[model samples]
Target: MIKNFTVFKRKLSHVCNLKPYKDTKWLMPNGNPTGLFVYNCVADQKVPVILSDPHIATWYSCGPTVYDSAHIGHASCYVKLDIVQRILKSFFNIKLVTAMGVTDIDDKIIKRGKETNTNFKSIAQQYEYEFWLDMANLNVEKPSIIARVSDHILSIEQFIKKIIDSDMAYVTPDGSVYFNTAKFPSYGKLQKMQDCGEPLSVLKRNKMDFALWKGPKPGEPSWPVSWGEGRPGWHIECSAMVSKLFGSQLDFHAGGVDLQFPHHENEEAQSCAFHNTLQWANYWIHVGHLSVKGDSKMSKSLKNTISIPELLDKYSADTFRMACLMSNYRYPMEYSDQMMQTAEETLKKFKFFLKDVYVYVNNNALQNGVYKDKLLDDLQNVEYQNLKFLKSDFDTASCINNLLSLMSNTNNIIKEKNGEYYPVPIILIADYVTTVLMKFGVTLKENTEDSVSNSIIDTLVDFRHTVRLNALTRKDKELLNACDIVRDKMKMIEVQINDSNKTASWVFTK
Candidate 1:
């Protein structure tokens, strides 16, 4: 028998066996229902997620352990979460108070301590700084709080005390404390299994039971505690941080799928045990893995992990971000030369489309006020279309694809003769592209220039465009010859000029 739920506190929106509906007070404004759902790893289905408060959301993401440099595999998780937060804030209009816990004191950090012949704290900080720098480079949104376990030791100790007082945790003879999983009853539901990994120490009551606090180990960092001079276990750090930071519950708990087992499962068990609630986090959001071309997983043991610094050295961060967004967040994304090359090429294409639009819109600014085109009229309710895509479980890839397709047609208008060249439609199409790109950590730069030389070039290009457009219908040989002279002269300075119908565009190929 698989015991799925246990007795718990308040009426959670979507937790354990209880599924609140349209009438539930927690849904939205006066409990009005809305189209919101998540592919919950816990429920293993697309469960409706109605936050305790629609306007304000409390989210927590499990951060790096900080023992080693972050890999691209690590980038995949954080970037995906960043995009999720952006959509929640932008499209869903949710004000987010997001927290990410950094595991600065862990077994991995201790191992690095021995290797470096230094205290674990320094080693953890060194890599933590590097990890965050990489995150910034990748355009990941900064978390509202970066909670380090070492900094929150007091709160962690107090958390352990509460669990102990609840009788769900026991202090062993060695002064280490362990959460008795047998007491929680719904302990295995997150990972959806009953059998746990082999006990880390024989002091634990059951093989499934995990440590709330570990006893002092030789050469490892330790803090003075009532139970013992030791650090909190990996699982307990996240659990305690969630409580100390966001009370006993969260709207969302996010991490890689690898954490679903002993890490997240143990956190879920400890949370419910400490709070006496069957549901702790309302929604469990997990990101899939980033695999190499030939490998199934990127692992240090397998000698296959690709570091972030290595990737950043070769490709632009935006290209890598594009790859992440194009791939489904729920599925595994393979890192390959072909995949990355495709991403680089894709970004270049978007750059090219924008380049043409910028030149045509700004140069023809005066005439565009009266000029109208049927193709431009076809792009209707783009905001509505984008929002509709967002409402459907945030299919961001499709949202991007929609813009790309629209731009493809828009680009056709720019490229082909008799195609429309107007500012409003160009702005309309670019607006859609820019809106989606912002969600993916991409910014479309519109730098202002006031240089006299630039103004001269802009005026010259506008003159060439005007004359060539006039020459097209007038059938004046002398005016056509003047257009050719301007084109030839611009080309001499490495500028490429092309004429399609009434529009003459020039680009500095150099």
Candidate 2:
């Protein structure tokens, strides 16, 4: 893990001699020339994601507010972010240390607690648990650090105090602290909005100024700060947590595009003011919204959500992940019946092709074939395209499209030889495809109940193969129909059968 800064620095010293390529800013730790460009929300253009230490990249992503069950819109953002993280760690070999903050102490939690007559902490905890479970089901990897505002209130207070000491923040008459946006020259750098330079008002220092600490409210959580008893504000929680974990600077800060205007902009302002630096984070990455019919963004507040559990009940996690992959990570993804149906069909196609190739390669022997050179060339080309698309802001849609083309081309070439595939090249293609898909959170295997079930399935496949062979020899059409019935029955249990003239094979259809 990249969590230990000492170990990271020790490793960085050895790789200092390796430099980035002349044409591109990004470089592999091994000094290989590679590139990864991401659209920086702050910069308003795609920029190279270069590693300062030649390997490690520090990232801070805003996490769920944890007042209710997460929805597909949340799923879209997390799954896509996980995809990018997978590529950075698995494909690019970048040592990524990601810290995600859970907004457990928010106004929503308080409001829900009051409505339900429950403890606010209990509400946050229950939903926080569900949130992690949902992420687990969606195959989102855990961040290097999971910071909750409740766990770091003291740090938050200290962070706010530092800003006040710097004279960029002021304490209100009600014992609340607000960030003085007018004092920060580059306050709206993230949103590219110019400061109004407005004078102080009776209620607030400026109209654009936001609270860093809200005075303690009855029935709400609060901690003692230097100024008074208060709770950390929404934007201040992320900034404080991020600064505590990653120090004065980090490589990346990411969240939903909806946060670009005030939330992320406020976070950037206070963080930069706290650090006394022009830049707190080098790259700002924002994921677009996930919308439903009527162009309404799916959100809990809108009551237009399909909860993670509800969505997973109708479709596998991989299906939802595939739906996300089919769309660009930086654009709105429409979650419609047609989108899900298309994702299911596409996943089925890939699964079927993989099953066919796996059976062929397993039962056959490796040998030279006429199209070996052609197939190899095709593999290299598709692999190149996969990397190219993924490197350019994680264009997973193009990567998946290219994989579809590879599958089609490979299937056609194998069919040309009457199922006589060259085992070596065929296995190579299968391995590569599986690797890429797995990185994208697509598990190709069905979750069988136990080893006994797997053994039974294997035995049944062999038994069916023998029975079919006997029927073919005896010229019994009735027995052939019985075999077909058995195969259809297997489909009910999510097992697929692939039959050849002499033998048959089976794979789980998850």
Clashes of 2: 0
Tens digits of per-residue lDDT for model 1 on 331-434? 89999879988876666667657667776676543333444465455566556677776665667778777777878888776665544446776777777677
Tens-digit lDDT track of model 2 for 331-447: 988888899989988888788678778666666545544348777889999999889888888889998899899888887755554555576787788889899999887887665
User: In TM-score terms, which candidate is top?
Assistant: 2
Query: All models: lDDT?
Result: 0.75, 0.82
In model 1, which runs have C-alpha deviations exceeding 4 angstroms?
Answer: 1-34, 199-201, 363-378, 445-510
What overall lDDT, based on C-alpha atoms, would model 1 receive against the true structure? 0.75
> Which parts of model 2 are misplaced by more than 4 Å?
1-34, 194-201, 364-371, 417-421, 448-489, 496-509
For all predictions, the C-alpha RMSD in Å is 6.9, 6.5
